[model samples]
Every structure is written in C-alpha cells, then in structure tokens.
Target: MKAAVLREVRTPLQIEDVQINKPGPHEVLIRTAAAGVCHSDLHFIEGSYPHPLPAVLGHESAGVVEQVGSEVRTVKPGDHVITCLSAFCGHCEFCLTGHMSLCVSPETKRGQDDEPRLTSKKGPMMQYLNLSSFAEQMLIHEHACVAIRKDMPLDRAALIGCGVMTGVGAAMHTSNVRPGDTVAVIGCGGVGLAAINGAAIAGAGRIIAIDMAPGKENMVKAFGATDFICAATSADVVKEVIEMTKGGVQHSFEAIGLSKTAEQAFNMLRRGGTANIIGMIPVGQTITLMGAAFLGEKRIQGSLMGSNRFPVDMPRLVDFYMSGKLHLDDMISRRIKLEDVNDAFTEMKTGAVARSVIVFDA
Candidate 1:
C-alpha cells in the first residue's frame, strides 16, 4: 500500500510503498475511503508537535471495513466507519466516568514486544495516532473507530472524525453552551466554522466568528455566525467583542492555537464564563493571563478531541448531517487524490480552503 510518510520534521512527506499487517484480535482493517488534511496534521509536519518519524501522517478519516479481527464485534465487513484518535480502554477511570477522550491507556496499542503493525522496505514503520489513514488501508484497534450509517458520504464523514468532532464537541460538551448564550470563536478555519455551527445548534442567540481574513466573513456567516470580525483590521479584538456584546460573551473558543488568541479568548468572556481552547498550541509555548481575572470567576481550560464519546456522538452527528442540520457539504473546498496530499498541506497553510479531502480509489 502507498502512504505519505513523514521521515523528518519540517520536511515534505514522502510517498512510499508501505506494508500493512492484518488485524489482530480486537483490531479492524479498513479500506481508506477519504481522509481530511487537517491543521492538526500540519502541526506534526511543521514540528509544532512532535511524533515518531517514518510514520503515516493522516488521521481524520472515514472508510469501509474490509476485515475485522476475531474478537471485533462493533463492526463487520462492508460497514462504514469514522476513525477517531482518542481510542480508549473501557475500564480506565476516565472512560468509566464518561470522559473517554481522556483515556491514554497502552491497552489500545500493541505492546513493545509485539511486531509493529506496519513496515517498509527500509525497516519497521510507525502507525500514527493509531489510525494512520493516509495509506490505502488502516489496521487499528476497534475502539478507535465507530460504525456510521452507510448512506452518509465517506468524504464528509471523514471531517467528523476529527475537525468536526473537536469543534462541535468543544461547544456542546466541553463548555456546554446553553440556549440564548453568546459565543465568539477565534478562527474561521474548518474547526472554527464548525464551532460556530455547533454553537448555533446548541441554540446560541448570537455567534461571533473571528478571523484574520476579511474574505471569510461570508463563509463564516453561512455556518451560523450571527456576526463576523476581522481580527487583522480590528484595533483590539477582545475589546471589540466586549463592546459588541455590551459586556462580554458567555463563551469564547480559541481555535487558532496561539497564546495571544488563547488569552484573548479568556479576556473576552463575561463574568463566570468559560473559555475553551480547541487548537493544539505548539509545545513549549506558554499562555499568560491576568491574576485578577480569577476574581470574576473566569475560567479557561483545554479541550481534547472535543471531549468526545465517539461510539455515541459520531452516530448522532451522522444523523444530524443526514437531517440537513450539519453544514458539511459546504465545508469541503476540494477533493484530491492521495498523491496530491502535499499540495493540500500547502493550501492549508494559506487558509485558502475549509478542508481538502484525499479520496482513495475504490
């Protein structure tokens, strides 16, 4: 199988013929259908986040089950599924307490003594974030993916695997945006737009979408943003948001993963409001805040994979899409083949599109 391999950081991914192993007990092998080129993958590509080298790069994806391990019962051959990075071990404290996204158990992965799931002509290869959907196929733990309705298109379903899940989950689960609340999302990229849409679905009375590009206002508004602010043109984004809301919003989301924006998200919150950071800020970067802000009970917290419980959330999200409530059709900017993955990353850096999907041959 051909896959995009990242051999080094701050370098282009190399397309190579990699070998995928068969499913072990509790594992599932899926034929790659579509994979989204998300900003999170760019984090690893640019060394903003670190990962083992010579690993496959893509993660946000959906596919069909080609084969299942002996013990796998959640899905079977021909089932359509979406892959998630937050694979959980069911008995972990986090999972037992309804926080499956927090689980980091090694039980979901092969032990050190076990043979690697992938390899190359050169040597052993690493399976990235459990799924590694950049390739023609994936061998992953059954827990890492959940079966979705077959009527749902795999390309759009791919977006739900990560970017959609993170944005929507942040608004609905992490912060619990109630009806009639005000929300300001910092960034209008795939995740940011989804946050706005999620906030609307949660019945937010007003949703403010912020971005550096003025051109994104129209696109952002279509996704349920009641207002749009160009951060680049504004003198002070936080002040502008506060002024527009007459004080401050009840919830603010930082989707750009910048320390400055994270702080702004905190500063733009009303008293006792919550700020959710959905972006993966680069390692070693620090966010500083005012000490006195705590007096008003303003709280800022990090959100992982939108605090998702994929087995339940994903299927419902599919239902939302099928019902025409989730605006997924407009989110896909373009579709390209596997070999064009590099160009997709280039486009992502420019923020020219909401999402670029890698469609695999059937």
Candidate 2:
C-alpha cells in the first residue's frame, strides 16, 4: 500500500510504498476512501506538536471495512465507517463513566512487544492517532471507527470523523449552547465554520464569526454566522463582540488554539457563560486569564473530540448531512489525490482553502 510518510519535521511527506498488517483481535482493516487534511496533522508536521517519526499522518477519514478481526462485532467486512482518533477501551474508568473520549488504557493499542501495524522498507512506520488514514488502508481497533450509512459520501463523511464532530460536538455536547443564545467563534477555518454551523443548528440567536481573512467573511456568513468581524483591523475584538450583542455572548469558542484567541474567547463570554477551547494548542504554552472573571461564574474548559460518543453522534451527523441541514458540499474547498498532500498542506498553511480532501481510488 502507498502512504504519505513524514520522514522529518517541516518537510514534505514522502509518498512511499508501505506494508499494512492484517487486523489483530478486536481490530478492523479499512480500505481508505477519503481522508481530510486537518490542521492537527499540520501541527505535528511543523513541530508545533511532537510525535514519533516516520509516522503516517492523517486522522480524519472514512472508508469501507476490508476485513475485521475475529473478535470484532461492531462492524462487518462490508460496512462503511468513519474513523476517529479517540479509540477507547470500554472497560476503562473513563469509558465506564461515559467519558469514552478520555479513555487511555493500553488495551486500545498494540502492546510494545507486539508487531507494529504498519512498516516501511526501512522498518515499522508509526501510525498517527491510531488511524493513519493517509495510507491506502488503515488497521485500527474496532472502537476507533463507527459504521455509518452507505448512502453518505465518503468525502463528506470524512469531515465528520474529526472537524465536524469536534465543532458541532463542542457546541452541543461540551458547552451545550441553547436556543436564543448568542455565540462567538474565533477563527474561521474548517473547525470554526463547523462551530458556526453548529451554533445555527443549536438555534443560537446571534452568531459572530471572527477571522483575519477578509474573503472568509462570506463563507462564514454562508455557514450561518449572523455577523462577521475582521480580526486584522479590529483592535478590540472582545469589546466589539460585547457591543454587537448589546452585552457579551452567552457562549464563546476558541477554535484557533492560540493563547490570544483563547483569552479573547473567555473575555467575550457573558456572565455565567462558558468558553470552550476546541483547538489543539501546542504543549507547554500557558494561557493567562483574568483572576476576577470567575467571580461572575464564567468558566473556561477544553473540549476533546467534541466530547463525542462516536457511535451515537456520528450517525446523527450523517443524518444531519442527508437531511440538508449540514452544508458539507461548501465546506469542501477542493479534492486532490494522495500525491497532492504536500500542496494541500501548503494551501492550508496559507489559510486559502477551507478543507482539501485526499480521495483514494476505489
């Protein structure tokens, strides 16, 4: 199988032939159909986040089950599925308490002594986020993927595996945005747009989209942003949001994962409102908050994978897409082949495209 392998940080991923192992007990082998090039993948590639080298780096994907391990019962050989990074060990303390996204038991991955799932001519290639959908196929734990309807397009379904789920789940699950509420989302990238769409779906009365890119204002409006704020010239974003809402927004989301934006999200929240951080901020960066802000009952929290229970939420997202409520077609800025992954990342770095999907051959 051919895969885009990250040989070094800040370098183009090498497209090379890689070997994928068969499914282990409780594992499933999926033939990759479509994979979304997400910002999280760029973070590790640019050394913003650290991970093992020679890894295949893609997490947001959807595919068809090529094979299943003997113990895998959640999906069959022919089922269509969306892969998630949050592979949970159902017996873990977190999973037992309904917080499956936080499960970190060793059972979810191959033991250190076990043979690696992927290997290149050099040696075993580390799989990124347990899915590594950048390759032609993915061998992952059954818990890492949820089977979805066959009618859903693999390209669009791929978005729900990560960005869509993260954005929508952040609003509906993490912060619990209510109808008639006002929401302000920082950053207008794929995740930010999804947050705005989620806010609309949640019936938020006012949705403000913030971005430095002037062109994105239109896209944001199309995604249900009630108003757009250009961050470039806006000296006081929090103040602008407060004035626009006649006060502060009921909920605020930081999707860019920057310290400044995260602080702004908290500052823009109304009294008793919640600020949800959805971006994967780099490790070791500290964010400072107003000490007196808590006196008003305001809170700031981190959201993991939209606090998702993939099995339940993924299908609902698929239904939402099928019902025409989720506008996925516009979200996909372009589609390219595996060889074009480097260019896609370059485009993403420029903040010129919403999402560039890697469509695999059937």
Candidate 3:
C-alpha cells in the first residue's frame, strides 16, 4: 500500500509503497476511504512533537472494515468506522474509571519482539499512532475505531476522528461548559472551530472565536461564535477578552498549544473558571502562571483527546452531524489525495484553512 512516510524531522514525507500486516487477534483491518490531514499530524511532521522515524503518519480517518481478527467483535467486515488515536486497553485503571482517552498501555500495540504491523525494505517502520490512516489501509486495534452509520459521508466522518472529537469533547467533557456561560477559544483552526460549535451545542450564551486570519469572520460565525476577535501577537489579548466579557469569560480554551497563549487562556478566565489546554505543547516546554492567580480559583488543565470515550461519544457525534446540529461541511477547506499531503501541511502552517481531508481518491 502507498503511504506518506516520515523518516526525519524537518523533511517532507515520502510517498512510497509500504507493507502492512494482517490483523492480530484483537485488531481490525480497514480499507481507508478518507483521512483528514490534521494539525496533530503536522506537529509530529514538523518536529514540534517527536515520533519514531520511518512511520506512517495519520490518525483522523474513516473507512470500511475489510476484515476482523478472531477476537474482534466490536465491528465486522463492511462496517463504516471512524479511527481514533486514543486506543484503549479497555480494562486499565483509566478505562475502568471512565478515562479511556488517558490509556497508554503497550498492550495496544504489538510487542517489540513480535512482528511489526508495518515495514519497508529498509526495515520495520513504526506506526505513528495506533491507526496510520495516511496509507491506503490501516491495521488497528478494534478499540481504536468505532462504527458509525453508513449514511454518514466518510469524508465528513473523518473529521470526527480527531479534530471534531477533541474540540467538542474539550467543551462538553473536559471543561463542561454550561448553558449561559461565556466562552472564548484561543485559536480558530479546525479544533478551535469545533470547540466553538461544541460550545454552541452546550448552550453557551456567548462564544468568542479568536484568530489572526483575515476573512475568518464568516467561518467563525458559521460555527456558532457570537463574536470574532482578530488576534494580534503584540496586543494584550487577555485584556481584550476580559473587557469583551465585562470581566472575563466563564471558560477559556487554549487550543493553539503554545506557552504564551496557554497563559492567556488562564488570564482570560473569570473567577472559578477553567482553562482547558487542548493543543499538544512540545515536550520540555512549561507554561507559567502568576502565583496570585490561583487565589481567585482560576484553574488550568490539559485535555487528552477531549477526554473521549469514542465507542459511546463518536456514534453520538455522527448522529449530531447527521441531524444537522453539528456543522462539519464548512470545516473542510479542501479535499486532496494522499499524494498532496505535503502541501496540506504547508497550508496548515499558514493557518489559512480549517481542514484538508485526504479522500483516498480526493
């Protein structure tokens, strides 16, 4: 199968033919239909985050099951599915306690001694996440994906895998935004827009979308943000948000994942409000907050995959999309095939598009 292989940091992914293994007892094999070139993938590609080299890099996707291992019962051949990076071990303390997204047990992947799931003539290739959807196929643990209705468009459904789930989950589960609450999202990319849309669905009275991009008013407004704030790097963003909400928003989300903006998200929160950090900050970087700030009961927390339980939440997200309550069509800025994955990352760096999905044939 053809896949985009990331062999080094600060380099373009080479589109090459790769090899895939059949399903393990708990694995499911999928024929990739559509995969979203997500910002998360870009993080790894650009060295913002590190991963093993010579890996197939993609996680947000939806496809049809072609085969299932003997022990895989969650889905069957011919089922439409959305893949998630948060592959759970199902019986870990996290999963047992309703925190499946936090699971990171090695049990989810084959042991190093065992045969690799993917390889090239050079050697064994690491799978970027449990699901490497950038390729024409994905061999993943059954828990890493969930079945959605066949009526849902696979292209749109692909967004739900990571960006949609992360944004919405951050709003509904991580911070638990309440009706009538005022909220501000720090970035207006795919994840940020999803947070705004999720805030709307959660009934937030005021949703503020922040971005520096021109021509973003319509995009943010379409996703249910009542107001748009054009961010200036040098401007006092916290002051702007505080003044707009008359004090501060009830909740502020740092979706951009930078130390500067993470601090701003906390500063823009009202007393007792929570700031959820949804972006993947680079390792070794730390965020600092004033010591006096905590006296006001202002809190900051990190959210993993929007604190998702995909099997339950994902299908409901599909229903939300199907019902027209969730705005997804506008999130897709372009649909390109796998060969054009590199250009999509370039567009992402410019922050000019919401999402670019790899429709196997797109």
Residue 21 local lDDT, model 1 = 86
TM-score of each: 0.99, 0.98, 0.98
CA lDDT, every model vs. true structure:
0.94, 0.93, 0.92
lDDT of 3 by residue, 1-362 (tens): 99999999889999989999999999999999999988888888779887888899999999999999999989999999999999999998999999999999999899989899999999999998898889999999999999989999999999999999999999999999999999999999999999999999999999988888857989999999999888855277789889989989988888887998999899999999899999888888998899898999999999888999999999999999999989999999999989999999998989899999999952
- Better by lDDT, candidate 2 or 1: 1
Per model, state how many residue pairs clash.
0, 0, 0
For lDDT, the strongest prediction is: 1
Candidate 1: 10-residue stretch with minimal lDDT: 344-353
The segments of candidate 1 whose C-alpha lies over 4 angstroms from its true place after superposition are none
Number of clashing residue pairs, candidate 3: 0
TM-score of 1: 0.99
Q: Write the per-residue lDDT of candidate 2 for residues 1-362, one digit (tens) a residue.
A: 99999989999999999999989989999999999999999999999999999999999999999999999989999899999999998897899999998888888789889999999889999989989999899999999999999999999999999999999999888999999999999988889999999989999999999998988888999889999999998989999999998879989999988998999999998899999999888888989999999999999999999999989999999999999888789999999999999999999988878899999999
Residues 138-215 of candidate 1: C-alpha lDDT, one tens digit per residue: 999999999998899999999999999999999999999999999999999999989998999999999999999999
